[model samples]
Target: MLYISSNLRSLRSKRNLSQLAVSDAMKFGLDQYKKYEYGKNTPPAESLLVISRFYHISIDLLLTVDLEKVSIGDLVTLENNRIVLPITVDCNGNNLVEVVTQKAKAGYAAGGYTDFSFISELDHISLPWLDKNEKHRVFPLDGDSMPPHNDKSSIIGKYIDKLGDVVDGKTYIIITKNNEMVYKRLNRNGKNTFSLTSDNSFYNSYEINFSDIAEIWEYAGSLEREQFKPETNDINNLTMVIKKIERDMVEIKAKMA
Candidate 1:
């Protein structure tokens, strides 16, 4: 969703700056500035760059994040400015993790960064054992590539604000700018990119550039939607071995007789 229009208005108002003053400073005509603020028109790439530098905020954030709901100062301070998480808190001030449902997973990579209301509409639950101070969210597992965490389970993730902060070999819920989310173990390739490998070896490892990333969420914990499945292979193998031993003993007795 486009938010630059509302963001322009919010940023200007928050700094106690008048529209006329901002228009003059931005070298934008008064009417043009009004049109941008009112969502009548979107700014071109050149204008976006100027606005981004002027506001000291990334263009991705300016165009996506709702500045009205988040503090511009905090958003600017975060590394990469990947996303403004609409993390909610409980009455006791504990962080309540928003659970992204199975259906919502598809849209999350898009709305999770762009729309504040979209996130708020998601169901939330509190995991008190975790550090109450950190931002976290719940995402449903999509494919079997990450074993033991198929569509039948969900993973709780701790938000990683910057791509560089990711630890090698650690699992993370990575959201790509192409609007795809996948869980994988990351290995930094020393080329501003990551080699994402799946737990299930059937899936080949792939390299993804830092620019392709939209958000990073380090794996915190997991919730199993299905019960543990017991394998009978070992039990059947043991039974077959015992029966073979008995047949061998009987054959020796028959030869002696």
Candidate 2:
């Protein structure tokens, strides 16, 4: 059975709260609260609710996850309580790549990436090309906006540690504060915005402000659903036709000679 004792102690220590202060805030006897932290007794549901509210954390997390190992930045608010990111680490303490499918894309945009319960419900798989030490996430692509990457393909992205690390002319998966996820070739426009261009000229490029960006993932590699077919424009088609006619004329001339 999972015990909340160690988690409670860790939370208190992280906040540097005194046991007596916590007991006083909960309006419980000091000895009773001490027993709760000592694992000799469990707090009542009401007391647990009060403690959870005070810490701004969910009761489930307080009772299950080891809070000492979780970083503050990794937590996100969900239904009035904070939950840690659902990152799975191997025995060697390496992060595993989590795949975001079409079905899970909407949820991921809704802060599901940091919600342990939501992330745990999604499917996870490992990739051979990715290093275990590097943080990565796979996102499924949907349109021909970025040709060659096409519809139904998936891109493996390495998590960019900072916005300053973004390189120009490289592809990235940009997650916006407005819950839009876009895959585009990025060019830094200024300190506050980026020019996002598409490989397919049919779609026009646009700029997104850095203030609106929630996260940035650098394109590492891609997995095609099938053989890739490059998008062709009018000029490309005309060039192909001209080349074919020239080849035919050369064949006729060789036969005549």
Name the runs in model 1 displaced over 4 angstroms: 1-83, 230-257
Q: What does the lDDT read for residue 69 in candidate 2?
A: 70
2-103, model 1: which lDDT tens digit per residue? 789999988898889999999999999999989999999999988887787678776656776576776545442333544334555555445579999988
* Top candidate, metric TM-score: 2
Candidate 2 residue pairs in clash (backbone atoms < 3 Å): none
TM-score of each: 0.61, 0.62
User: Total backbone clashes of model 1?
Assistant: 0
Alpha-carbon runs more than 4 Å astray in model 2: 1-84, 90-93, 230-257
Best by lDDT: 1
lDDT of 2 by residue, 137-202 (tens): 888887878877776799989877467788999999977767788899999997778999998665
